[model samples]
Structure formats: structure tokens, C-alpha cells
Target: MKIDKDRFNNFIHSYTKDELFYRSLYNAEREHPETFSQYVDTLDRNFIEQHQLYVPSLHDSWFPYISENEFFQTYSQNIYIAKHNRYSPEYLHKHEFYEFFYVYSGTCINTIQGKKQTCRAGDLCIIPPETKHSIAVFDDSVIINVMIKSSTFHGTFFELFTNNNALSHFFSHTLYEKTENNYLLFHTQSDTVIRSLIEDIYIEYYGHKKYSDSLLDSYLMTFWVILLRHHENHLESFLNTTHQNLALPDILNYFQANFMDITLSSAAEHFGFSVPHFSKLVKDHTGKTFVQIIRNIRLEKACRALKTTNLSISSICEIIGYLNPEHFNRIFKETFHMTPSEYRKKHTNL
Candidate 1:
């Protein structure tokens, strides 16, 4: 029997109301039990019965292998979203790319790499590549799978994740780690923004509106930041964090990009730390003081100018945030063990 389009759409729209679908399916199965037979195979168009759901079992095996190309339109985009009315039992299988899921409604019983967790609505399951996981979908539950290739995270996000936080181990899983269990569960049931953004992802994935991919990328990145920020807020213990490499490159990159006007006080304020705390953090992470970092960056620029450009020493001094040529010369020589003029002669063509 063909699914009632109206009833099917209702279940899709009102995900939390799985009982409505069950009641409808119950009525449909009363008339046609054979209509529900085709629901076993996920690839079948009739896999979703309007009024029926298969009883999920405790099967421990490999999860189904889903090809990236089947979901993604292009490798460069490398992202796709798939929704399911939770009923089938997932197997203990792993994938080649980063995969995460959002519980749209009800709960998802996820056994992740030998660990089990009950994922409720608004919970996010972050499973890294090659990690075994199985999801036992219960009746009246809906799940949305967001698949992203490893290439998608080869940017600033990777740096931020590995920027030496105490919880960094929970997020980034190495492809060739000695040991393999890695996954994260971001519990965000009370967060409205995360929930709304996730739902919008579902809409955009199916609707395919203009610039949906770009918009989704922005949303996805922001979603993780929010999740991490939420995680950071709950961090009450910092006693064992002394050994972490707090070398936040993105923060340093910002100073480099805006070196002209960045000050110790301003930089500290930008990162929401006190001046003393910021100074200590910078020193601990980079082994350089705020002034030293700024001075080193300015001197490097002066060196480049002396070699590549025909600017005079006095002009270069003024250009590199220095008012006195003698002062600039003294500092540059102290750092490089050679005067600016001598360095220029040695490296640049006269």
C-alpha cells in the first residue's frame, strides 16, 4: 500500500510527534500488512510506512556503509544531511569521514566505540573517522545525520580544536592514532540557537535554496564554536592544565594582521582576559612577551623593507612604528647582531 502523502508529511514536519505516525501506521497496517514489508530496505522508496515502524533490535554488527558521493553533490562542498524516522537497528561500523548526528526528536541510543550514551533531543553526536558506532532507533524518534569530509575541517577550526584546551582530546581524533576510541556528545537541549540552527540545516539541505551550501557552512562552523564555548564555560578545574600548549595561532595571527594598533591592554581585552592574565598566557604559550612579539614582528617587516624596497633607514624606522632611527637601529642590531645597513648590504642588491 502506498503511504498517505499527507500523513507522511505530517510525521516529517512534526518530528516530536512520532506517536501520531504510529497511530496512523497502526491504522494502515490493519488494512494492509504487506505494505509495510518493503520498509526493511532503506533504499526502497516505500521504506517508510505511513502508520508503521519496525521494532529495533539489539543487533551488534557493522553499520551500513554509505558512500559520500551518494550524499554530497561535489567533493569540494563535502557536506550532506540525511534524515531518518528512527526504527532500524544500526550496526557497529565505521566510516572514512567525519560524521555527526542531531537528535531532532525523542532519544537515540548510541553505542560509540564500545561506549554507550543515551542521546536526547538537541544532543549532538560527533563521531570521527574510523570509529565504530551503532544507533538503536526507538519508535517515535527522528535523527538527522550530518556528514562532513575530513577536508571540510582542514582550516582554522582544526587549529582552534587543537589549540591546547583541556578537552581538546575529546574532539580531534587522529587518523592514525595508536588507540582508536574518539567521539564527543554536545548536550544542548536548553540551547535555542543550536536547536534552531540544526533545524534550519535540515530545511536548507532539502530545500536547496540559493547559497544554501555557503550558509550551511557558516552555520555549521558557528554551531561547533558555540558547542565548544559551552564546554569551556563548564570548566571548573584548571589545576592540571599547566602543561597544555596554549599557543593559539589564530590569536597570534590576529596580532600580526593588525600589528600597527594592537596593544597589550587592547589584545587582552579582545580575548576577554585581564592584562596580567593575558601577558602570562602569551608568555606561557609562546615564550615571548607581548612587547617582544610586537617588536619581533615590526623588526621582521623592517628587515624585508631594507632588502626588497629602496626606503631609507630613517623612513623604514618611521614606517615600522619607530620615531627615532637610532632607536630602531639599536634594536634591530641587538636582535640580528648586525646593523640594518650592514644586513641590507649583505642581502640586497645595491
Candidate 2:
């Protein structure tokens, strides 16, 4: 799908309805600080329903849980992108999806896990699921907020990072491990590729056509690989100082590719670690034993085949490292509360 450059620019630069209301409120507050509170109260009394983003007291004691259904709606295909409203106040909340904040211009304050940081132009902040965070663009700044379903990360986007490096390790632990409060920030100062990729994603999103979802996936993968290859020096991660040796990305990739025959000892040897150390590392990083990881990978692949392919259950079992159809059916029922045929039939209806 292609989009006109001029139209894309106009779409991005246009002020949203909420943004207009917040801009006017910001102007009033700046012009009259002494009576700004009273003015805000008057607005609250008359037009609060139209302008109030959230109740001021909502973030005082408890952070609201933002669910995927609230913002994704029924038309979404696992991704949502929008511009952060200018002059919006800090309303702290947590969501059950991955969020990316790209500072397109000016600056914005991003509070993650209770630590405030100012992100300038060319900075991309990635917040994982269940992380407490809020973005406040109190000035004339352009911040693009891109939200992706957590299932997408676990199923598709994360499969690109197969090499043993900081990038891969961070993602593996953040996605499958027991660690919490994790995020990544990349500072791509004046990188034309990064900027262009961001624009391409936004444009593809706004001008969605046939195969736009696949195109967005390609663009996002390219954007992320570019960051890993060129901007590693400018990367900031929550687990930067810890778990440097949890290089499980390559191992996880190996399992996914060779789940039919790969053994724990062979995998350990391929990665140049002893059997004991490899098992320990896998447990520490993924919170699952070696066999459990392999089983999970195999079962997950079986699910994909059931959803997207026309293969028979016995064939899928053999393809996913199972020799016996009876065992595969038993395990599949144990995990999904349904037999493989039932699962396939249910998804076919959907």
C-alpha cells in the first residue's frame, strides 16, 4: 500500500479534537496562573465531559488498568497508532499491551515505573505490558504513540531477534521471563533511516489498504533491526546491568527451528555451555525448565498450524516433535481445554 507524502504529512500535523481543547486550556492557565484553578473549575462544571482526559484524582492512590479492548476496539488488527494530545497532564496508568512513544519533534516527559525522564526528538521509548507509565506532552510537541497487542510480541515480532546479543536477551527475558518493570529507550540522533521508517509506519497505518498489516509488520521489523544494528550504543534498557549472560535468544530460536529433534544436551553444546549451566540459564531467564520450553514451543507451533493450515492432526503432531498422536491430543487438551480437532473447528468458525 502506498500513501501520498503530502497527505500523510497533513494527517500527522493536524490537531485532533482533544488536542485543541487541551491547547486552549493550557493557554488559559499560562495567561492567568492566579485564577487558573477557578477557570479550570468553571470549565469542569460546564464542559468537563468534553475535555477532561481523566479525573484528576484517578492517579492519586491507584493507577487505572488500561485494557486492550478499551483502545483497540473491533476494527484493530493487533496495532493502534495515535498522536499524544498536546498539553495533556500526567495521568498515570498501566496497560496490558506494548506501547512505543516516538518523539517526532520537541520533547515530552515520560514517567516509567515512577521515574520521570524527558525524551527529545529521535528518542523511541518502548514500554512493555503491565508497566506503570504515563506520557505528558505539555508543549507543542509531536509524540507518536504506537500500541501493539502483547500476543503479537509473543507470537510474531519477537521472532526476528534470533542472535545472541543484548537486544535478543532483553526481549527474551521481558517477554517470557519473570522479570517486571522493563522498558527500552533508543536514541537515534539524526538517523535518516529511523525517521523514515517511523514515517512509513505511520503512513501505512493511516492509509491502510490491502495487505497493509503485513507491510506494517515488515516495516516494524526493519525499523527494529536497524536500531539493533546501528543504535546499540545509544540503547538504554531496564536490565542493562543485570542478566548479561542470559543470552537465550539464539537458544530460543534454535528450539523453535529444530523442535522436532533438538535435545537439551545438544543445544547446550552448540552454545558452548555445559549441560548444567545451560539448564540453569534457561530456568533463570525463562522461569521454565529446558524440557518445558521445548514443549511450549512445540505446542505453540501446533496451535499455529491448527489455525492457519489444513494439515491433519497426526501430521501436525509429527511436525511439532510429537511421535504419538495420542500424546499430542492429550497435551493439547490439557493446555487448551479442548482436543486438537475441536480447537481447529472452533477457529475455523471464527
Candidate 3:
């Protein structure tokens, strides 16, 4: 079936009200009970509906320096960039699409979810879908952004990338690993090579040469592969030298249990290592610091609270283990740039 651009646009816009589409799908299924499975398939085939769910707005509480639609258009892969004057409570919010950010210039403290790290030029950060994050630009910063729809993977290639044990394991576990909360930045010693890759992709996407779509796809897939490979190599080297077996389940379980009381030292203690060693382990394994991991956990909790609960900002902060209202406000604003009250007011379903 041919992709309907208009329908796609409608689906994208309707994502903010996903219940309406799901209800319609349910009605359609009820009408065609015998083909209910087929009805669901039709949504995917007709509207690419499997991936149509909206990622909540990243900056609903703050004035966006860039338009969401315009940002999506520039990259042609659903990405955008913006410069901010102050620290945002979070870094980037994602839906089902994977997002990449390259710091072009300026110094910033980025808190992805909750952990804080500082970022400067040549630092690249990737956020997978459904993650909550925020950033505080210490100075005005230019960020190169890219977003890729998970469903964009199709056919045999999709299976190869999605179903492959190693790749799937990485995606399931460490794809969204934090670098730093405030700006735990990676220094790009070879800035030229990374910049070249970014420019090449951008040129192919915008230049629109013959077969550019296919070329862009190839470049994107290669880019992802290279990125994943880099992380995998780092993890391997870390494990081989440290002789520490950091399993995914252990890490996840640790977060789930200790997320409320999560601290850098606590995380280090959980793994039975010194704080510095634990910090290095996290950076090596996931390219993020201990603080970032904890913040990610907190931001996720905050997102869930914002989405589902009717808790007051103070209550929500308490629930998420942030006792200092001012600190929570600072962090929340850095990630989202909006006060929690403002975010809840805007996003709350009436």
C-alpha cells in the first residue's frame, strides 16, 4: 500500500490525543470482529500507526526557541535543534523515536532525567524514546538534533537490526545510557571526523540528490551501527580490564529499588566498588556517569507522575525522592524549563 502523506500528517498530529485513535481502532475491530487482528494490521499498514503514539512535549512549560514541525522538517528525519538562554530542567524528551544531540558550541550542564553533567563542544548524546531528560546550558549552546522512528526499520533489515541478539540486547538495555546529568561531557578529540559524518548526513538529506532517500537511510543505519559498536567496544574493554560483571538486570533492579534514594555513592556501594571506580564503570559501560543514571530514573518517575497522577508539585517531588523543592525546581526547569506546576497545568487532561 502506498504511504498516504496526508494520513501520516494527521496521525502525527493526533498522537497528542492517542486515545481517540485507539478508540476508533477498537470500534473498527468490534465492527469487524472476525478480522480484529487484520484491523490492527490495517492501522499499521495504512497509517503506520504502530509508531504514531506521541512523545510528550519536551518543553511544554517553556518558550521553544524552535518550532517542533520546523525542526522535524530540517532533518527530514524528525529532528530539530534550539539554543536556550538558561538551564532547562531536562535535556530531551522522546517518544518512540531515537534522538541524537551533538553539542556544537557553548558550555552546559545537561541533566538527562536527573543526573547532571556538563557538556561542551563536540559532545554527542543519544536519547532513546520514552525517556525523560533536561539540560541547563551554562552558555548559549547550539545542539544538532536527530530523531529516528523505530518503525522506520523495515523488511529483512528490520529483523537484522531489531532481532539480532546482540543489537537487541543493547537496545533493550543500554541504548539510552546517560553521559552526565549536568554536563558529564565527552570530549571529541577527533572533532573533524564526527563533524564530517554529521555534515555528510545533513547534506544528503537536504541536497535531495537522486536516490537520496535510500542514501540517507544507508547513512543513518551505518551511523547507528557505528555508534552502537563504539559503546559495545567500550563496554567490552571495561569488563575485560575491571573484571566486573555488570549485568543489565542487576543495573535495572538496582534502579527500581533505589531510584528514590539514588545517589552516586549509593550506586557505587550497590555494585561493591569505590565511587571513582563505579563512576568509571558506568562511563565505560554506558558512556554515562552514576549521577546521570540516577537522574534518568528520577525523570522517568517524574514523567509517569506527570502523566498519571494528580499529585501536587511538592508531593510529586517528594514521591520522586527529591526533598528539596528548590533543587527539584531547578532540576525540573533544567530538564523541561517549565515549573512542575506549569507543566502539570498544561499537560493535565481535563
Candidate 4:
């Protein structure tokens, strides 16, 4: 398929919150005059212009009961895209497949099993089959729903995610290895690679002629590999996010935010757990002890600073919470197999 990539990107990026809300109001008014105000939570001009307070009927967006060939091309051509517009009916029902929703532009409120999650731009959500979920989206939200078949998700494809604990735990926890963890929300940080892959799929589907289906499968494989590559850097973050423990979120977030000075005793006290109890819990869940976790976080931060900043090695160590420059340098070299200066110089050239 021949696609004007520039024009497509321009059109995708064109809608902001204001434009989306105003356009929705215009459409709603045209479709059902004077009923738009009835759905508004607040009766004000600012609300009318900047936010879409109403939702359209769910009847129009109902799932189709049809064969794969009738739906698209072939049964093997399982992957496809669906759009979630605020004006369209909400697809609350579940099916026998996976739906990965990527918030491509703006933001939306995603409700999975009655729990609400505000997914901003660049966020990706993986919703499994038989899960009761719906998206209470707003104006300006471009939710790209990538549907993956269960049959195609196993064997060699599934092993890619299973190689790591965080993603492995997440996908497995959602796909019936465990319960209580329904879906995963990945903050992709507006990765251009992911955006490009989805756009390629969109273009190929719309302009399908000859070999687009096979090309789409190739794009999907590359897309998963890229996502895994980018996400491996934040394994602990993903673990903390997918953790089913109730107290872990606050403890993990606070620890990450204050990694410079946090200790096991202080963290235990703060979380209202005894030192030994807290230590055991952390180990059981994360497979790493408290000090090891903090040390890794600090070292990761120091590595980023080394590559991105022009700070002295001693200052870099201090910034990452090391009092002794020699100790920091020793560990840095041991962990990364290179000195800070050498690592920085090598990455800078690349």
C-alpha cells in the first residue's frame, strides 16, 4: 500500500482536547439537539468547550458475530485495528481474544473490571479475553485497538515476553498463569517506533491489495521485539506496576522517588511492617532484596547521567547517593564492565 506518511501523521496529530470537544459538541448537537447539556456534569461554558461530558449510545459499537474471512481477509489474518471514538458505542463485552489498546493521541479513561485508569498519550493497555472492561473515553482520544488472536500468541511468539520476569509475570498473570492481575498499562514514552508500526498496520489494512497481510504480520513481530527491547530497561518499574500486593505500590513509588537515602529499616517502619517482615515480603515479590534494589536504581540513574550529562565522576557518584567516589567507581565498572568515563565516551560516539 502506498501511504503518504507525512499527511497521515499530520492528520493524526491535528486534534487537541479543545478541537475534539468542540467537534463532538457540534456532532452531538446535530445528532441529538439539546441533549448534549443533559449529559454534562458541570453546566458551564468552559466545560462545554474544553471537555466532552457526554457519551453516545453503545448500540452502534457492538461487536460483530462473524467469521474471520467475512470480518477481514482470512482466519490466519487475526491481527487488526479498531478505533474507539467518544461518539461510538462502548464495546463493554468480552471476547475470546486479546485487545491491546494504545492511546495514540491525547488521553482516555480506561475501566477494566470496574477499576478506572487514566491512560494518557503513549500508554499501552493489554486486555485479555473474558475480562469485563470498557473505556469511558473523551474527546481527542485516539485509542488504537490491536486485536491479537490466542492461537497466534503462543509458541515462539510467547517466549519473547517470557524471557523476563516483569513482562513474563504480567502477560502470564493476565493470560491465566494467575488471577487478580487483569491487564497491563505500559508507559511507552511516546516511542516513535511503536507509533510507526501501528501506522504501518493501519495503512496496510486500509490499502490492502496483495501481500499486505503477510507484511502486517511482519510488522507485528518487529513491534513486539521493539517493545520488549525498550521495556527491559525498566523491569522493576513494570514489576511494581503489575504487582498484585496492595501495599507495594506506595512503598515502591516512595522508594524509587527517594532512592538516594531510603533504607530497609526506614522503609519497613514507614510501611508499618517490621524490618524482617518487610525484607521477606520485598524479596518474595521482587526476587531482590531492599539494598540490592536501591543500589540498582541508583546505579541506573548514574549511568543515565553519565551518558547524558557532563558531570565529574565524583559528582556523578554523589548525585546517585554514594559518599565515596572510589566505591562508586568500583561498582560502576563491575556492574557495567566499564568505567564511567569509558562508558560515557563509547555511548557518546554511538
Best by lDDT: 2
lDDT of 3 at 75: 49
lDDT for model 4, on a 0 to 1 scale? 0.64
Clashes of 2: 0
CA lDDT of every candidate? 0.62, 0.77, 0.52, 0.64
Task: Give residue 52's lDDT in candidate 1 (0 to 100).
Answer: 35
The residue-by-residue lDDT of candidate 2 on 1-350, one tens digit each, is 35576566566667877787778777777798788777666654345454446435232543478787665654446688778888766677888888888988888988887899999999998888777888888777799988987655655666787766666777777766766678999998778888778888888897756556667777888988998888988988885234665456767777777778999899999999999998888888777898987787788678767766789999999998899999889988997688999877765412
TM-scores of the candidates are 0.50, 0.74, 0.38, 0.51
Better of 2 and 4 by TM-score: 2
Q: Can you tell me which runs of candidate 2 are displaced by over 4 Å? A: 1-3, 28-52, 57-63, 67-75, 240-244, 260-281, 289-350
Cα distance off (Å), candidate 1, residue 162: 7.2
Best by TM-score: 2
Better candidate by lDDT, 2 or 4: 2
As for model 1, its CA RMSD to the true structure in angstroms is 15.2
Q: Per model, how many backbone clashes are there?
A: 6, 0, 38, 0
- Deviation from truth (RMSD, Å), model 4: 18.6
RMSD of each: 15.2, 4.7, 20.9, 18.6
